[model samples]
Target chain A: MSRAALLVLADGRFPAGGHAHSGGAEAAVKAGRVSGAGSLEEFCRGRLHTAGLVAASLAAGAVLGLDPVELDGAADARTPSPALRTAARRLGRQLMRAARATWPSAELDALAREFPKGAHQPVVLGLAARAAGLGAEDAAYCAVYESVSGPASATVRLLSLDPFDATGVLARLAPDLDRVAHQAVEAARCALVNGVDALPAASAPLLEISAEVHAAWPVRLFAS
Target chain B: MHLDHNHTHDGPPAVSADAHRPDGRRRALRIGLGGPVGSGKTATVAALCKALRDELSLAVVTNDIYTREDAEFLLREAVLPPERITAVETGACPHTAIRDDISANLEAVEDLEDEIGPLDLILVESGGDNLTATFSKGLVDAQIFVIDVAGGDDIPRKGGPGVTTADLLVVNKTDLAPHVGSDLGRMAADAKAQRAELPVVFQSLRAEGGVKDVAEWVRGQLAAWVA
Candidate 1:
């Protein structure tokens, strides 16, 4: 697997439709749980362990040769919010376009043909990682990093928090990020043997509830 | 290697400029309008829609920063049916949606085509942003950068990507030029210096047939696209 290819897949500028989304950070910030850089760090950490962990595991599972359709079902079960489901599938379709253009795998094409609307984004990320000459771990790392990075970047805009502070928060969370990515790969490996049911179903009720509220807002910065 | 072999060229494309629905029909020509806040990007889209709706099938996609104001305004004016106009939220960075990361905008255009398709043209209007903001070639067949005379005549002299690289530059609100102390001729000359042979249209939507030149330019683009 090429390290350069992994970087290309993980780059925020991957043109996979990530910028328009704040993950669940916009809702958290509006709820005042993420006002300043310090709070932003706490919010990212929470998301990293829960949504991030689940997403990473799903991605790693995809790389482990799990059925994309089944993994998509698992992803939907893990994500409770309908609005977030829409965002995930929407982003998945966008990533499909970019990944297909970059890697052009039959697997990616089949997925696109199957879910013309979209599958969950993490599932596509794993497929993209495989197509990019990357490993399950690379897919896991991409999912975990994006889970926190989306919110940290959005908080910088939402709260006008110091940009350096946001960067610092991400830097501070690197150790935790590493731990979650490692755990996700392990979970994926286990799920490969034990079945997709073994994948973690961690949920953040607040993120789910807040996502629905944010979706109903007449106006918002991020799409979800 | 397995990775290299995994991606055979025989499969269908993931992304391409020659976009097609699964059925193999040609998609509508996408044109983007970008400019600074209140420079009349939305107004240009409205006028273009009005001018071409009778002649050609048309739809619109608007990227609004933190609001649906642009889409709402167009819908309120009844330029096109509400179904034909879609708004994409830009997350406060309008340029990012049009230039750096165009996934959302692409989705909006494709969705419009899917819901009300076989259309001839789709106008993508960008939220108000700086001079550096421009549309990606992947997103639009051509782009028009709109700047009003009231913004300043020297804006043309301070050429950025939008001024030089845009397929066309529109100097809007010609009626406001005299009142705002702007020199239209000097602006046009500066525009020429910045863009060697590219076209620039001075327009005032308030005037009758104000968007005529731009509409004609768009017709030429659609002709080329079909040809």
Candidate 2:
């Protein structure tokens, strides 16, 4: 894929309203689960391994032209929190709008029309990757990057960390990004070869709990 | 370009997404307006732009968790030029981007300034967050907390930080007070009691050209900035 394409997909500036979310980090922070950079890193790493892994795998499946309805169901099942689920669909819809505009494709438009509300981010990202002509690995990379980067970036702003130091943390996670991408592609390949309808199941129960608690706070920095 | 045997790319060089970024010094004052869901935040933003756009070069960034509904609303109203307005679909949790991780919001503001050239103000409208939703100081220079009389007359008495500490507290929808059974006097008293010396404005966006009073306040802030 062209570098411009990759930039558009990963640029935090994209019109996909990712700014309004903490990716569960806010909830984790309020619950005393994630305090500092190290704890934040650990929390994000866990998400990358669990939810991030699932998102990557599903995105890979999408790149391989799997059914979006099936993918949507699978994603819904993995996300137990109604708040988180609602969030994912909202993000997915926004991503679809930008993705459709930048990289027009019939499949994406059809998916957007079919599931107007409640489409998960991974499903739409996968379709976008396919439309952008990115390979499964790149698709997986973008998915994981989007998932983790938002929270990691949010933590920096929330905590008022040095911007340079924050970038260093992101740089350190580069290796993990590669690892998760490879794992996603492998999972996608396995699903294809084995004819399994199920995608990889990896979810964090604690994140869901935190999200719910965060939702009820009288004063909070992040939405959820 | 020949694909490398290994997974690493050997084709064209990967474009650094953050490369050659514009000078950070000359950016506009990114202001985030956040409050409860449907607290007239969108209405406030639209009114502000309509009132202030001619005086100052402006752009807007709106965060709508699932839809571009707010952005679309502004576009439909023609509050600002289409190119000057951008929406960030936050996916979920409107407070996160405004307060927790502001990269996306920051980037959006910067991108607008980059495309539109130097802007005096960039208003970022957050998706309706709860009473607690506040913008991270890192993302915005000033913040506004909005509440409508229709949500509840006692909302001011609740006295969350957003109601108390935001640069300004806007008591919107006063015109609806009679219809909604909200006590305008009690709300104003509660807000003044809780806010102490902080300023508050009660206006009916539907009636008073919606944004005139708040627009004047914004002008005062901008004047102070220049001073």
Candidate 3:
């Protein structure tokens, strides 16, 4: 079941449209904010902490059978960028289609019906994960992995970097994925017990600015 | 603050029981066109609107990294009602908006659907990108990857995921094949070799009056959806 869930979530063909984006790596690369492998790692690490963490936590909540509506609202409040929020919700809708097709659960169907005015990806993914009968750890792992893989894959295409080198970067980040997943499960438990409003708020201003600037570029390689 | 005596219901009673449902009926099929810069993504979109607009309730969302150039082009051509076409300024990496985040595009699509009411199709045109660029599955129900003959017949041979895996691959500007010394047949063969059974349409938007073959395929997808 976990394997099937992973395959559905990780498959590039699933139709959530992750291929067009580079997380924020494209703008970071263009601005010289990320130049070499070291900077790439740092950028990924930062994302893993903020957006990645939030997504993982939401996914965990979904795995734990918490309310997706509340999780989606929390995700919206956490993601400050309108562009990012928009992207997440689009992905959420797509993910919903795929998840419902694969799992066919009442929880997923209900969440899809109740998806508020602006639902994003992580919340939907979490609910999908639960519907698939996966646990919080599994959902967290998928959320973090998807967030990082997008940029890692984009860097290879954008820079013409050796595929082996890109894989190496991903391999190095693997241990952190485990750590982040654990952290996410814990966070999710806290949020479920006390509500997402009780969780600490963290924002990444530079990344937000980069997304805005990247949006304004006359030409670009990635979407966001 | 004292409550008004005329108010029968006490201050905004909890949740509005009649809050309109967010998810309405199934939306029109959304198709995204993405590929390298100058690969004729806009021309393909315009041709699609011309070909399919009358048959389908259609709208377009064009992503321009900075400018609303593609939307402007569609408007200039009057492909659809001005209200049906929208532009998203992706601000940085066009891919991120289409791939990584996708919120703005989602809202644009939803807004279009809400305003138009029961539209049959929405086309999202991605900003120009490299060989690997592709639509997030979330963004479109199906996607078309456009590569012009001038970009080289070799592009198909290069074999990126977009070339090998997009639901449809459109080799545009086939009319320019002779001028550019490109082998349209060989390009088609190469694409088929890479994609196995997936379909490929070689189009000259200039000659064919806007991708009739691809437009037809889109019609088929919509037909299947209804079925």
For TM-score, the strongest prediction is: 1
Which has the greatest lDDT? 1
Model 3, residue B174: displacement in angstroms? 8.3
* For model 1 chain B, the run of ten residues with the poorest summed lDDT: B1-10
Scored by lDDT, model 2 comes in at 0.78
Full-model lDDT, candidate 1:
0.90
Report the C-alpha lDDT of model 2 over A172-213, residue by residue, as the tens digit: 888998998899999888887764355788878888877777
Best-to-worst ranking by DockQ = 1, 2, 3
True contacts kept of 3: 0.06
- DockQ of all models, two decimals each: 0.55, 0.09, 0.07
TM-score, prediction 2: 0.55
Candidate 2: lDDT of B200?
92
Segments of candidate 1 deviating more than 4 angstroms: B1-14
- Residue-wise lDDT of candidate 1 within B1-227, one digit each (tens)? 01233444344433756555444667789999999999998988988889999999999999999999999999999999999999988888999999888888888888887788688999999999999999998899999999999998999999999999899999999999989999999999999999999999999999899999999999999999877
lDDT of 2 by residue, B150-205 (tens): 99999999988799888899999888899999999999899999999988999887
Poorly placed runs, candidate 3 (over 4 Å): A1-4, A11-13, A116-118, A198-200, B1-57, B60-69, B86-111, B118-227
User: Per-residue CA lDDT of candidate 3, range B1-227, in tens?
Assistant: 12234433222111111112134245567888999999899988988888887777889999986577888999999999999999875644677667765656776787787677778788999989888888877667788999999998899999997899899998988889999899988998899899999999988777756577998899898887656
TM-score of chain B of each: 0.93, 0.88, 0.88
Query: Which docking category, incorrect, acceptable, medium or high, applies to candidate 3?
Result: incorrect
